[model samples]
Target: MILILGGTTEGRIAASIVDEGEKTFYYSTKGNEQEIALKHGVRLAGALDKKELIRFCREKEIRLIIDAAHPFAKELHDTVYYAADELNTPVIRYERIYPKLDTDVDGIFQHLDYDGVMSSLREDKVRRLLTLTGVKSIAKLKPYWKEKGVQCYCRILDRDSSRELALKEEFPEENLVYDTPDESLDELLKRLRPEAVLIKESGISGGFLEKTAIIRQNKIPIYLVNRPQLKPSARTVDGEYGLRATIDEFLPQFFPLHTGISTGTCATAAARFAYAKILSPSPYVFIDKERIPVILPGGETIPVQIHSFSGSFSLRRIEATVSVRKNGGSDPDVTHGMLISATVSIEWDHTKEMRLLKEGELPEIIFHAGEGVGTVTLPGLGLEVGGPAINATPRKMIRENFEAVIERACVPIYSTPIHVTISVEGGKEIAARTFNPRLGIEGGISIIGTSGIVRPFSSEAFVNAIRKEMEVAQATGAPRIVINSGAKSERMVRNQYPDLPPQAFVHYGNFIGETIQIASELGIERVTLGVMIGKAVKLAEGHLDTHSKQVTMNREFLATLAHEAGCSDETVSAITQLTLARELWTLLTPSELTAFTSLLISRCAQHCQPLLPNGELTVLLISEEGVIYG
Candidate 1:
C-alpha cells in the first residue's frame, strides 16, 4: 500500500509512525548498514532507478510513497518523485527540522554545492583540512585535495565497505579517519590543527551546531554546503502527528483507531496566535490562513490551525479573538470538532483593566472563564472555588507561549498585562454527556490534556479520567471505589454497593491496570474491579491492558481452562470453536461453572494484587445474562 525511502533519522521517524497501523508497508534503504526495527514494514535493500522504481510501484500496488531519505540523496528523491507522478500516486515528504543559517557569523562560509566549496578551498589554498562528511563524498571532494596535494583527513564509518569506497576513489588510506574517537570534536580539531573544517547543513539531529562550535573555538574557517534542491510540489510535514493525519487521509483504514489533539492544546494554540496577532501589524485573519506550530510538553512542535481572528484597537487596550477547531482524531469525544476559542486583551497602560489585576502582581498573563468554559465548585480538583476550571498543564503552556512572544516583541514583562479568556462553544450542552457535574465542574468542559495529544480507545485520556474520578471518590471519604468496564457492568454491580456514593462508580474502559494503579498510588484502601466477559478473559491470562491491540482472545488457552475445570471433551472442543468469550456461558453446564469462575478470578488476582499491596482487591466477573461469577 505504501513505500518509504529511508536510511536517515527522518526515515526512522516515518517508520515509527507507520508501525502504529496494521497494514504492511515497504521501507527501502540504499544499503544494509543502517539497523532498524520494524513491526509491519518489509525491508528492501539496494537502490532503484526511475524505471525500476516504476516497476516496483506497479508490482507492489503502492498508492502512497513517503520520502524520508537523506536530503543529499537527490538521485533517489528524483527517481521516487518521477515514479510516483507517473503512477498517479501521492507523496509525503518527512522533512527534517532545519535551523536558520546565519551567514553573518564569523568562521562560517556558505556554498550552494560541493563544487563551490572546492572552488573556494582552492582559491584560499588551504593546506590541512578536516572533513566531517561521509565516505560517499570522497570522489566529490577529491579535486580540491588531490590536485594540490592538500593534507585532508576525512572522517567516515568504521566499516570495510567504507574504506573500500575511498580506496576505489584513489584517496589515500592514511588520510581517512574512522568514526568515534574517545576525544571530543573540539579536541580533535586541536590535535589535527587544520586550516579549515568542512561540514554540511545537516540540521539539528546531525550535530551540525556542535561541530560549528568546535570550529569557532579553534577559530578555523568552515565551509558549509547547503542541502540539494527538492521538487517544488512535494507535500511535506515536520511533526509525527502530521504524518499520521496525512496517512489517514490517503488510507482511511490504515489504523484501526486514529489519534487526536486535546482541548488544552487547541486553547493554547488559539491564545498563542491571538496574542501574537493582537501585537503584530495584521488584525484580521481568514479561515484559510497558514497553520501555526505549537510546542508540546515533550518539546516537539505540531502545527495547529488558528482561524476566525478579529482584532480591534482602543484608547486603553487592544484585543483580538481566535478559535481552533479540534481535528477528527481517533477519540471522538464531546470536545472533538468543537471550537475552543481565546479572546486576548492587552492593556497598554494597565489603566482600563487595572481592577482585574491583584496589587503588586507581577505575572503579565491572567486567565478567565468565558461563556462555555466551566468554573470550579469544589476543593479537590486543585483550583479555588469559583475559579476557572482550566488545569495546571494548560495554564503553564499558555504562560510559556506568551513569554516567547513577549521576548520577541521587545515588550517589558511589567509594562502591560495580558488577559486571556478560554471558552468552548456549546460547552454547557456537552458537559451533560461528561463527568464534569460529578467532579464539581459546572457550565462547560474543563481545559485538559496532560500530553497535548489523544490516542483512540485505551488512551491517556481514559486513564486520566479514571485518576480524576478516584481523586473525587477519595475526597468524598468513600471507603471503597467501584470500577467497571462500562455502563452495563457498572449498573449490574451498583446494587451490591448501595451505601457508596455516586462518585464511587468510575469507568475505566480497557484500562484495568491503570485504574487499580492510580487507586494504589493515591493510598485508597479498597478497590473493586468489575469486568465483562471479554476483558476478563484477557485479564485472566495476565494481560493487564485488555485492548485487542495488546492481546486478543486465545482459544487454546480457553480450551486449557475448560479442560482443567473437569469439562468433557465435547465442551472443551466447543469453547475452542466459540466465536466470542460471552458464548462460554451458554456452552458451560451448571456442574462446572463454579470451578471455572474460581480459576479465572484466581488468575486475574495474581497479576492485579501486587499493584495494590496496601489495599484490598476484589475482581468481579460479570456475565452477559447479568450473572455474578466471583
Candidate 2:
C-alpha cells in the first residue's frame, strides 16, 4: 500500500516507522549493498525509471510514496516526483536535518557546483588537494584533478565496493584513502597537509562538523559544495515519528490502526502558543484562527489548533490563557476531545534575581497545578511529593518552547518569574478511569507521555490486528511465530531469533491470552512469548489480559515468590514496598533474582501453555534493562 525509495540512513528509519504495523510495504534502493533491517517492508533494489516507477505503483496499488533516497540523487528524485504527480499519489519526502546556515570558518568557501571548485583550484594554482566528498563526486571532479594534472586524495567509505568504484574510474590506488576511525581526522590532516580540502555541506549526522573542526584547526582552505536543493514535495518530515504521523494522514486507511499524540504534547503545544501570544501584538491575542506550531521532543515541529482565550494584562504582569483540545486519533484515550488549557503570566522585575544575574541564564520558569491537573501524593514516580503532577519530559518541553518564543521574538527574558499553569477540562472525572488514582495522583489527571506519541494498540483493536498477523504467519510457513508483549519486548527478543522474519513476530500489547488463542485456532505450531518484568509478574498470577486497568501489580503475589525463592525477610518486605516490578532487580540479590525469575516465568508458562495446547510455548522474561533470561 506504500512504497519508500530508500538507500540512505533516513530511508532505513522511515522503513522502521512504517513497519510498526502488520501491513506490508515496499522499500526500494539503488543498490543492494546498504545493510538495513526491515520487518514488513519488501526490499526492492535497483533504480526505477519514471516508467518502471509508475508501473510498480499501479501494480502494487501504492497510495503513498516516501522519497527517502539520498539528497544528491536528483535524477531519482525527479523520476519519483513526476511519477507520483502523474499517479496523483501523495509523496512524503524524508528530508535530512541540515545546518541552518553554512559553517562560519575563515578558510571555508562555498561552491554552488564542482565547476566553481575547479575554477577556484585553477585560480589558486593548487596542485595538491584532498576531497571528503563521496566516491560519486570523483567523476564530477575529473576535469579539475585529471585534466589539470592535480594530485588529489579522495576519502571514501571503507568498503570493497567503494575501492572497486575508484579503480573502475582509473583513479590512482595511492590516491584512495578509506575512512576509518582508526585514523583520526586530525592525524589525517597532519599527514596530508594539502593546500585545500573539499567537503560537501553534509550536515551534523554526516560528520561534517567533525571534519570541519579539524580543517578549521589546521587553517586549511576548504570548499564546501552546497547540497542540491530539493523541490518542495507534497509533504516533508525530518524525523521518523513525523514521517509516521504524515503517513497516517496521507494514507488514512492504509493501516487498520492509527497513531495518536500524547497529552503531554497537547499541553506543551497549548502552553507554547499561550506564551507566544505574550510577545505578539494585541490583535494576535484574541485571534486563535491560525494553527500554532510546537516543536516536539523528537525535534519535529507540528501545528496544533488553539482555541480563543481570554487575554488580559497588567502593568507589572501580562497573562494569556489558551487551550488545545486533545485529539486522541485512533486511541481510546480518556482525555480525547478534552480541552487542555495553559495560562502564562509574565512579570517584570525591578530586582534582578540570581537566575537573571547569572551568565547565559534566562528568566525563571515556575509551574502551577490549576483546577483539573493532579498533584503528586507519593514518591517513586520521580516527582516531588505535593508538587504538580507534570512529568519531567513535559516540563522540559514547556521550557524549551518558552525559550524558543523569547529568542524568536528577540525579546529579553526579564528577571521576573514566568508562571505557567496547566489545566485539563473534566480531568478529575476522567482520572477515576485511569491509573492516576492508584498511582497516588490526587485532584486530577497527570500530564504524561514519555515519547509524545502514542501507538494505537488498544485491547479490541490490537486483538483484531493480531488475528490477521497470525493468519499471515500460518500462510507464510514460518517455522515459529513470536508473540511479544509490545515493541519493547519484541526488540529485546530480536537478537535471540535473528533469522526470524518480521512477519513471524507480533506485538501482543497486553493481549497475551487473546494472542495465544488466535495462534491455537490458526494452527501455529510453535510460539515464543516475550514479556517484560512488569507484565511477567501479572501473567504469572494467571491474568489473561495484563492491562493496567485489568490488573494492578499484586505486590503480595511477588512477596510470595520472593519468600519461596529463599529471599531474606528484608528482601521479601522490600518486594512488597516496590512501586514497580523492575525494582526487583535492584532489591534482591543476583542469586535470589535468578530464582525468583524462574519461579515467575514458570508460573506464566503454566497459565499460557494451556491456551496453545496443540503448540509449544516458550516464555521469555526481559529484564527492566533489556536483559533476557528465560
lDDT of 2 by residue, 94-118 (tens): 8877654434635678888899988
| Stretches > 4 Å off in candidate 1 | 100-109, 119-126, 147-149, 181-187, 209-222, 272-282, 285-290, 305-307, 313-318, 350-365, 374-418, 428-444, 459-630
lDDT of candidates 1 onward, in order = 0.81, 0.81
TM per model?
0.65, 0.77
Looking at model 2, the pairs that clash are: none
| Model 1 lDDT per residue over 264-363, tens place | 8999999988888875655574557657667666445677877677778888778888899986475677778899999999766643443432322335
> Evaluated with TM-score, which candidate comes out highest?
2
lDDT of 2 at 81: 89
Q: What local lDDT score does residue 149 receive in model 1, on the 0 to 100 scale? A: 67
In model 1, residue pairs whose N, Cα or C atoms come closer than 3 Å (at least 3 residues apart or on different chains), thus clashing, are: 258-330
Error of 1 at 249 (Å): 1.5
